[model samples]
Target chain A: MNEDAVAGEKSLKGIAVYPGIVIGKAQLVDRSKVKIQYQYLVNTEHLNGEVGRFEEALRVVEKEIASLKNGMAEKVNDLSFILDSHLMILKDNMLRDSTIRAIRDEKINAEWALKKSLEKIRKVFEQIDDEYISNRISDVENVTERILRTLSGKAQQSLSEIDRRVIVVAHDLSPADTTELNLGRVMGFITDVGGRTSHTAIVAQALEIPAIVGLESATDVVADGDLLIVDGSTGVVVVNPDDRAIIYYQEKKLQLEDYRSSIARQSHLPALTPDGQRITVMANIEFLEEVTAVRNYGGEGIGLYRTEFLYLRSKGFPEEEDLFEDYREIAELMAPESVNIRTLDIGGDKFVSELEITKEMNPALGLRAIRFCLKRPEIFKTQLRAILRASVHGHIRLIFPMISGLQELLDAKDILEQVKMDLDRDHIPYNEKMEVGIMVEIPSAVVMAGVLARHVDFFSIGTNDLIQYSLAIDRVNEHVAHMYQPFDPALIRMIGRVVTAGRSEGIRVTLCGEMAGDPLCVPILLGLGLDALSMNARSMPLIKKIVRAMPMSQARDDLKEIMGLYTVHEVQQYLFERIGGMFPELREKGYL
Target chain B: MEMVRRLKIRNSLGLHARAAAKIVELADRYESELFLKKDGRQVDGSNILSILTLACPKGTDMEVRIIGEDSEQFMTELDALFQGKFGENK
Candidate 1:
């Protein structure tokens, strides 16, 4: 069995959107090959019948959509808007009337007429200048494709039906198609194209399904009913696995479930050390809808609410009221628990089409974050006005990102003050004492944290950016990503300086980067005296469990020993030994 | 009675999806035969696809024509919509 597995096993790598392991039979769904046969009617008398056929197809697709909506009604929230829009497209006169006209005038079959109508509409959409607006063409295509599939009698092959559990392999799954999947029978999904932030990925995470996207050729390579193993955490897909490999994955799958159940049991408990020192665990979110998940995972508050998504998702600048509504909902939902809103961290990796920011040789160091806001104060002020208006709804704290020095911090604060004055003059109620802070990500910010701390209420060390900037490594560049070490002696010492500065000035300091949620680094961060650890919502439970079992005093002693280590390897090994010795149960459970 | 109203699209995104949805929602309320004209191209007021095809970007001048018993009332409501910038402020 081992030799057979070694001889026949093939593995593929992709982006891990959700973490789980599953072994199941492969079910390939190739919607891209759904070809529409263009046929012409032989007689003029057939026009009425052809139109009727098209109408019937539309009705059938509408019913399918309604059932899809019904299937997700209680389990999913906020999906009705998208499903309703698809229903509207089904009833659209432009689509219906144009197809009817084509069938009557061109003497074409129902499928051909509908395709022609969709093609005409898609051509017009292509001419639109805005990328966000033009992207609507895909929605039109998705809807028309569904109707076309119904006309071709291929609609029933969608993931809505499966007598046995299978791993779905497809080119891509639309939001609507993803909702139609039978949760009980669908073990996981592997797609040819998608990233961690795509809508399909988000839905997969919400559904708690194991998914690996960007496989590039998973649909073409895997055949139906072939044995398959999907490890979403490692983004590895093994096809044609033998008995030994299947057994290995089955054991891993069980271990993952056990770990999840153990964490779920402790989710409601407070994150406290054995000595009774409390550590606040919060979630960093990019969308308001994630607040529910944060609450479910026992996040005390939203430590970092990224506001740039509102701008990037819109065709142009998001209106103040639209921004206000989003912030208000998040604030109202998490009242008494603080929601730290980071204002406009755009540039470098995130670019808005409307902004027309010229491509730079080094976007990471160029006009981004506070620099972009300072250059365009009106854009900055508009966001400030909306955030200020939302401040009165709940505990909302404003934090400026990428503040390289004191001037940028003061300038941003100055615009904020002006927005507040305008709101006050308009007789708008806002929290006058809303606390403001700056992210100490850049090395200069770390050097000048003492001065910056005096001006702001708190400091959040964005370790993701700090490590990149301090080490001069573009973490995204694969050639140098190996050099992006979080355990570097210089980086740890810099973090120590910032934490010390925040402590001496009597201001709370938080860590809200990828490093904060990492269980291996939690002790190091706690020993550095971080007031809060903000991470993804899913990571909070395990991190909290680890924090609750260890004493802060022991962690501090380990931190001292770690700081004395000369090399990154030495620090990591020493910390692992100490943490493993302290929690043998965790080590046995493969958590340490 | 027949009525016509000329207005400029003040919303930054022009007649995009949400804006078109709002227009269709409003137009569906009246029994009048409403049409929008921009650059000599006419589109049915209640049809989102036709409205989107017009590609009426921000600041584009458009004319709305209505012919029915309730044309005057429909014209008044549409005039308010235009004046309000379709409930979107720059």
Candidate 2:
């Protein structure tokens, strides 16, 4: 529950990332960036002392990286090489000599002089034309950012150490914060930033926790240990709910628990529509630990197995053995069913954006996903080799992310072929017939799906990016989030084109997006005749129940009527009216 | 000894961080001044960032100039490292 709303109840609103109701004491963690941005000038007498302070900070950072290296190497030896490179950067002469020169000659404090030197080096890095080599600018940025944090003497709060079950409220969780946070102790979370598909939001959905994000001021409003009621379904946070409101939520909580238990009992059943059409429902997961949850939630297999954690966990392009171990575990765990591994889907900006390195207006539009991988084929090859090596352990397929063009698709395949040839020469065993696919997210990819369909084994539609890119509205921005509509007539037609293209090529077309998990969007997906629907594991049972309840002919008929609708509101209203009439029992069961 | 040798950067990633680290580490062991000249721009061999700035891709022909007593020994080690592609087989 929330802030020091001690005397009276208050209401706050945000975009709901996950659907659930939870009442807990608020844990107001201060994840504020250190404000070491103050400026100072050293006197001529103190300039040497200022220079000495900078040297000491470098030593501190060096020691920190070394310790991280030693500790991480114990688990994965390949990680140490990445740190060795960082060490070399830390001790680079231009970085050290210039900072010293700035302190002595310019008569400024060490922090400011170091910042100046970093700016100079960044300028040099910016001039480089090679995008991959230019991206090394972030390595410089990270080393500088680490040193700045060291100088400020305010280390980040290790979120994994939180012991008590509570609602975590933060300004914005960095990629580090999102990955390392202790989910076992978290009851719910509310943040001042992030959209429905943001890193933190995806984590919350995968773990099925109650979370609300983009509150704009939750950090300013919520106080520690205050009684707060978070309704993730309604995107409402009540600070210190009154007795009457408590009674209402208490009853609703019981109903949720009841519905959850009932769903778990039937989640294992195959989803067959009334017209005898079977749909494969899989789960999108980031961590290997989430494999168990997919099995429990009746997921047929893993779809969109995001490989972001594999690289981030080890702090670099992870070792092939480590990647192989993880992929093999998931493949073996989900034996008969296939696991679709989506390769690294991040960009250079993810590491630098939060650190304030460069002013990239839109990280989404910048170099990311397939573009990033293709630029640095060394990193891409590592993951491809791991996936290929792990294919023999169990049923595994490969899916590349953000394929905006046919060339990117072909280039990725060429790398895959090269890796396979390397493995063949080395006598390493792998599934030679492993299915390869591409995520149809970018608008250009959808328009050219017909041409691209000739090459790939399957297509997994990533609707989150499709909606944002096509609509030209940033979902994270609350101002334009209202425009992030799933039922827009344009999207329906685009999806129809993709489905027809896939059908003509005789390849399975599935969806692995947030839309697949949504109850209201289920009929629309069914109408498109998608072969498989993958989503958050928790959403599977309800989706299956809906699939069993409605006939495909009915959904197709409903789709035909909605396809002619001009606006998002009209389409949503029509679906709501149709659902209310067709599935009256779902409403009674609290499923509608 | 004073000598100059031309060598090709053979690694898939070019003169990247780890490769540069090997060159820097080798240069530090001998009392020699080693410099790599690529495309008319030369950088100190003992400095990692300088080597990175050179940005020599996999097939770039780099000119190495050395001066001092241990120049011969330094050349032998640098040649071995470059030929082995800094042991990066990925």
Q: Which 10 residues in a row give candidate 2 chain B its minimum summed lDDT?
A: B11-20
Candidate 2 chain A weakest ten by summed lDDT = A348-357
lDDT of 1 by residue, A1-592 (tens): 3323432548787777677887877876664556778888988778888888889989999998888788774524335545656777787876888899999988999888888888888788899776656767766877898888888876655444344678988887754455446656788989887655444555566556888887878877887667788888777888887777777777777888887888877898999999999999998887777888898999999999988766654436777888898899999999889999999988876765557677789988999999999999988988898899999999999999999999999999999989988998999999999999999999999999999999999999998789989989875453455566778888889999999999999999999876776667877988988899998787799889889988999889878888889898887787677767766655554454
How close is every model to the real structure, measured as TM-score? 0.77, 0.71
Q: Report the error of model 1 at residue A475, Å.
A: 6.6
lDDT of candidate 2 over A1-592, digit per residue (tens): 3223322447788888887788877766553343456456646668777777788889988998887776553554545655777788888887889888988887787778878888898888788765556667767777777787777764333222235467888877766665435457788989888788777788888888989998888877887667778877767888877886777777767787787778788999999998899999999998888888899889999987988876665433567888899999999999999999999887632553212224457778977788878987987999899999999999999999999989999999999999999999999999999999999989999999999999999999999888988999787676777678888899888888899999999999989888888777888999999999999888898889889888999989989898889999998888777776776645544444
Candidate 2 positional error at A116, Å? 19
Evaluate all candidate structures by whole-model CA lDDT and list the values in order.
0.81, 0.81
Chain B TM, every candidate: 0.94, 0.96
Q: How many residue pairs clash in each candidate?
A: 0, 4
Instruction: Provide DockQ values for all models, in the order shown.
Output: 0.49, 0.48
Runs of candidate 2 exceeding 4 Å displacement:
A1-9, A33-163, A348-359, A580-592, B1-90
